[model samples]
Structures are given as C-alpha cells and as structure tokens.
Target: MAASLLQSSSLSLLLVVLVAAASTARAQLQYGFYNTTCPGVEDLVRTELLAKFAADVTLPAGLLRLHFHDCFGAGCDATLLLKSHNGTAQRDADPNSTVRGYEAIEAVKATVEAACPLVVSCADIMAMAARDAVNFTQGPAYQVETGRRDGNVSRKEDALRFLPPADGNVTVLTHYFAVQNLTMKDMVVLSAAHTLGVAHCPSFSARLYNYTGAGDQDPSLDADYAKNLTAVCGGPSNVASVQPLDAVSPTTFDLGYYQSVATHRALLGSDAALLNDSLTAAYVQFMTNASSVDTFFADFAVSMINMGRIGVRTGTDGEIRATCQVYVD
Candidate 1:
C-alpha cells in the first residue's frame, strides 16, 4: 500500500512541476505584461507618435513599413535597429535603404525608458509604435503582443534574402511570405499598407523604360498610368527621389491602393503582379470598394499582429538593449 501511495505522490509532483514550467514560459509573452513594470508603455508610445504623426501625415506609413521590414528579416527581433558593427546592420540592406522612422522610434523609446528603466524591450516599443502609427493614420487599431527581446545579430544578407523584391512575381512573393508561415492572403492583406507609403523611382523604372530590357514599357501596365508614372518617376538609375504608391489618397489608409493596383497604377511590379493571379485579383477587387474598407482594415490588423510574431525572441533568449540602435557592447 505504501509503495502505491509513493508512486502516486511522485506522479502528482511531476505534473505540478510541468505546469509550473509552462506557466513560466507563458510569462515570457502575454498581454498586460508590463501592467506592473511599465504601466504606461503603450500610452507613452502613442503620445510620442501622435506628436510626430500629426506634424507629418506621411510619418506613420514609413514607421509601419519599418516595423514590417524588421519582422521580415528577423522575426521582429529589433535586429534592424542594430548599428553597423561593420556595415552589417539589416537597416543598411539595399532593399531597406529607404526605410524611415528611426527618429520616431527614438522619441517613443526615450519616453518608455524614462519610466521603466530596463523593463521594456525595444522590440516591444517598435511593435507598439507601429500600431500607433497605423491608428494615427486612420487605420484599424489592434492590440500588439509584447515581451520580445533585441537580437544580437543583424546581417544585411538576411534582409536581402528575406525581403520580397519590388520586381518579384506572384509566385516569388508567395514563397517569401510562406517562409514566414504567412499565407498568400496575408501577403495581399498587408499590401494594403502600400496605401500610405512611396516607392523609390528605381524600384518601378523597369515597367517604364525596359519591361524586358528592350526599352519597351511593360504591356501589363495601363498605358495611360504608365505615362503618368514615367513623368513622376526618375530614370532607371535615379534613386534620389520617390513617388507615392497611391497618389489618390497618399496619406490615408484606405482602399485606394487596391484600386490603383486593379487598374495597373501600382508603383511596384510586385503590386501590379497581384492582378496577374485570380486569387490576389479577387482581393484587389474586393478591397478597392468603399464597402470593404472596414474589412481591409480589420484584415490588416490581424496580419500585422501575425507578422509581429515572426521569429520573436523572448524569455531570456536575448538581452534587452539599453539603446535600441545597437547591441550592448
């Protein structure tokens, strides 16, 4: 009888230990994680963004784009913030050369750091700043998960390898998003972000001067729209200036981008490629109309939250950098 009782006790204890370990892991990431440590982290981020975003309506778009770029290269690890140890920072990658909003992140980071010394991670700050930017731009507001940590490494090669190129076709873009465990629909939904940002002239010049290197415009592009793009965009070699992806409502987060894409007015070939596929084309048609604006916003929110989870580091896996722009020396 005593032997059986001892065996039962051991089983109970093992169960208890396993449950405790699970709880500890859960603590690594949860909503209201900083309710005690930094009660005002979200508000601080929003306030800082309001000031910056209000002054420059375009700021939110770039900030949101920056957040996505970070997630793509390293699962929202804040690797993009790592300063170049030797020209290796992800932010300096060619695809990311035009990414903006570092100063905006600094403004919010300063506020969070003031109240909660080492309690908040820069990765979380970035996630929240991105959410606030979207909300500030009249996009859908969504809750972002926190407790991510700053990664120690940042390589330009990773960014180049992971980011979907402006000239990528539907198949290439689909594969890239799939690698992140994101579906083709997620790729189409997130493309709604193009509603607010701009593309460099070099990114889409191929559709103008040389769709196939014969100095002929891409037939896929609407001829009238191509002419308009040619006028606004610089030469194939010109990287100095950028043109808005959605000129109709450049600063607004609406369905105008999908409308632009549906008509072959999208700034990047990747954007134009959406129309080449039946599935993606359906999304473009549905989102372009006013009735689907709310749906698009809601879909964008879900995808953004999903994107924020890519390759996240939490639970003592990485350090919380004192400054967001570099690994701790």
Candidate 2:
C-alpha cells in the first residue's frame, strides 16, 4: 500500500509540474500584447490578408498551412519563413515543399513595419494571420495571443524530424502532437484544416497506386472515391495534379472533412488513420454530425491557441526580424 501511494503521489506531482509549465508558456503571451507597441497589428494583417484573399480565395489555406509548418519547426519562431542560406532551411524540407503564402506573410510584415517598425515579430504576425485565415474562411473567429520572437536557426533536418507526414498513421501522428504538448483531440480537430486546402497528388499517391508495395490501392479508402481520385491523379508520377482535400465543400471551413473521414473518403492516409485510434476516432465520429459543427469550431480555435504556444521564444529569447525571409544582423 505504501509503494502504491508513493507511485500515485509521484504521478500527481508530475501532473502538477506539467500543468505549471503549460500555464507559464501561455502566460508568456498576451491577447493584446502588441496593443501598446503595434496597436493595429491584427487589423493590419487582416486587412492585407483580406485584400490578397479576395483576389485568390485559396490564400487562407496557404497561410494556415504556413503557420502550422512554422510552429512545428523550432517552436513557432517563423523559421519556415527564412530563406535557405545553403539550402538548409525548414522550408526546403519535402513535407514543407507545398507550403505557400510566403509573399503574403512578407506583405503583412511590410504593412506592420510601416506603422510600427521593429516592434512586432514575424512569428506573432503568422499566429495572428492564421487566426484571421480561419475567420476569413468562415471558421470561428478567436483571439490569438502574441509576443513570439523569430528564431535565428532553421534547419531542414528539423522540419523533417518535426512535421508530421502525410502518410503517418495514428501512432505516428499522436507521437508528433504529444511532443508538441498537444492532445489527441487537438490532432483530430486540427486535421479539419484539410477542409480548406488542396493537396498535391504526391502526398497521397502511394495509397492510390501501391498500398503495400504490391500495386494495390488502400482497401480502407472508399472505392468510388478512390476511383475518382485515381482519375484526377492519374498515377504516382503525376505530381503536378492536385485535388481538394474536402470534395464536398472545399472552400468552406466546415465539418465536411470529418464527414469524409467518417466515410473512409479521406484524401491522405494520415487523415484516414484518425479512425484507427479510439480517442481520435470517437472525435471524428462525433464531428460528422451537423449538430456538432459549433463544438468543432470552438475546439479548433482552442487547439490552434494551444499549438501556438509550442516551444515559443519570448522575453528577449529571440530577435524580431526586419524581413521574415532573412535574419536580423
């Protein structure tokens, strides 16, 4: 009984420590962090993004993906925005090859700089832009905390090690999220971002052509959907071809991605793997119901806020870059 009590006590202490750490991380950022320094920072980013997005409706997905990729590499420090000095930056990684919106981010940064030069960090700009991206795409509008600083280092190897793969199974994906202090529920909710993006054929082509290297399609994929994808994608070599991750309502930020996952019509193997885990699977199933739309939106906003805190640099830890594409001298 004494040994059991000791073990339980240890576990409780560990939980407390974890909770404290998370609290500290969140405390380092503030909802109105730039109000004093860059009072209209969010408004500037949103305005620039809105103008760009009006010209191209797909801009939201690119900005959102860009933020996710940046956060995953060196903790939301905007490392993904840095240009590869010797072809070694995070943006050079295979997983990040499809990530877009660099120009948009730079454009927003320029606007912010014009008003409050050397005051706002590119990292915060990305976090805020992602929030606005969701709101612009008809998703929930949530407040994003700022005060993130840009990291000086960005390695392609870090991106390769950190970013979850398109073909990752539930086990692989869960580990990635856990390393970032995110829950499995966050994994499922964030996967709904797929609803707004278009994926290149190379991301999911293996499942269509060679499931196990035997020239077989993924049996778990819906047959009719697979047929349609096969027609759209042609073969694995057709890397240039692209398809909407959510066919039903590709432009809207809704529960359509969950519906696709629940029906085994998920575009990426990793998306389909959500059904293999009990916790994530339950969330996927729950989200498929139209009534659960509000719940999913709220959850997504919370998850995004949580994700924005990962490995964050603040309070003189990193520098605020003059241009997102290059480090400050």
Candidate 3:
C-alpha cells in the first residue's frame, strides 16, 4: 500500500511539471510582437494574398465592414472567422455583414485548407486581408502577429456601430477611435489608406452636387470628371461628391494624402479633419513637409501594429469556432 501511494504521488508531480511548462509556453505566445517566423505566421501571409485576389471581385460590403468593426475596436479579434449558421437556426434580422469580400475569404480559406486544414481562423484571415489591402497598394507591409482564434459569429449592428461613415467628421472620428484606445496620430496614419482604389460616382455624389464650398473646388479634377460626378449625384442640391481618396496618387499607397490635406484639397471630411483638429495638426504638417519617406514609413508600421492588436481575444476569452460565422462546439 505504501509503494502504491509513492507511485501515485510521483505521477502527480510529473503531471504538475508538465502543466507548468505548457502554461509558460502559452503565456509566451499571448503578447508582444511576433514576426513571420512565429507559428502560423505564413498562414497570415498566404491569407493576405488570397484576400487581395478576392477584393478584385464583387464582395459584399458587410464582410469587409465586419473586419473593420472588430479591428476598429480590438485590433483583429477574428470575429468574422466564425462559420455561418449552416442555415440551421432562425436567421436574425441582421445577419453578418456581407459587404466584406466573401470571395476573398473563401479563396484564402481554400489555400489554408490545403495546408493546415481547419487550423486557420477566419478572424485572423480578415485581419490579414485588411493588411493586404494596404500593402498591395504600396503601403508598408508591417509585421502582424498570428495565432488569433476564430470568432464564432458576426453581428450586424456591431459592424454598423464600428465602421466609420464615409463622410464622418473629425470630432466623430476622434471620439470613435478614442473608444478603441487609438489616438489622432493613429487615425492620421490609418486614414492614409485612401491611397488605394476608386470611389464610385454614387458613393460621393453629395460633395460634387452640394459643394458646401468649405474648401476650393478640386482644380486637379478634370472638368469632365467633375461634370460627370455632378450628373450622377442629381444636380447641385445633392450633397454627395465622388473624388479619388488620394487626389495626387489614388492608386499608390503613400503619404500624399497628407500633402493634399495640407493644401486644403482633402477629398473627405474625415481626411480634412486631420488638419482641422488642433491635436493632430502638427503631425499633418510634419507628414506634409517632412523630407523623409522613412519617417512616414516608420509611423505607418507602428500604426499597423496598433490596428492589428485591436479587439484581440486571448487566453480563455474567445473561442476558435469550427466555422467563421456559426456558434458550434
């Protein structure tokens, strides 16, 4: 009986040590910056490429909105990584936003499935996709940490609340990020995302028609383009305006948006606010006149890190759902 007790005690001690080692290892993965060498790091890279390809197609805006929703509040919590309800449950009035590129998510999933099977989470995939959108347009490819688990569901109201409006003003935007623990500096850097893509005529018709006459008309805009924008927005009374995010270089990702804003040519109310706000006014001046591209690049890298860390779920807080939109064990 004594021998049996000794054997049991020895076994318990071994189990305890093993548990301690595991705890230490997991804790190490929980915080701090991780490079591409970290576990599942390559998955993010591959997923980013897939996301870019998906963005090229017709994707629902809601999916993209969900990604922004989570990132705005909690870095990249992988909330969109949950699987859809498999059509089993009664559909809620507000299903997950499909504005995000589903084709992109699916493409990224296809690649991940081939390599790691279901190990990759959808939430992480969307985070990578956001980064991909920035980087593909010539922005900095900042290092992002991997190993975030998938969220079990997407909520519609959640997306609407977090996604910044297309024409959100400086104060609304300032308070919005404040709720997420972000600063004006961070907002300025992220807003530089305008360095990519084109806005449809319908999206910004208000500015073209109403012409609040806040800033001078865009001298650089082709007369025909302005006229066309006016027509699409339904004459002078309509408040919408269609302008490329980066008037100087819409297709390339750079700090030129700052240059435009400093010149009073900022296309969006939010972009113009960087200069209007007293707190971020100096940083806008620095970006506009600074001689170094390196300065902008460095700030952008830090901002990217901040964005990736928003709304993250760690330890025992969030689940790794089997599907990105569903709540299943």
Among the numbered candidates, top lDDT falls to: 2
User: What's the C-alpha lDDT at position 46 in model 3?
Assistant: 53
| TM-score of each prediction | 0.91, 0.91, 0.69
Candidate 3 lDDT over residue span 30-53, tens digit each:
332233223564555555564554
TM-score: the better of candidates 2 and 3: 2
Worst 10 residues of 1 by lDDT: 320-329
Query: Candidate 1 residues 117-233, lDDT tens each?
Result: 888888888889888888887888889889888888888899999999998888999999999999999999998789897888888898899988899988988888787777776
lDDT of 2: 0.90
lDDT over C-alpha atoms for residue 246 of model 2: 88
Question: What is the Cα-based TM-score of model 3?
Answer: 0.69
State candidate 2's TM-score.
0.91
List residue ranges in candidate 1 displaced over 4 A.
1-28, 327-329
RMSD of 2: 5.8
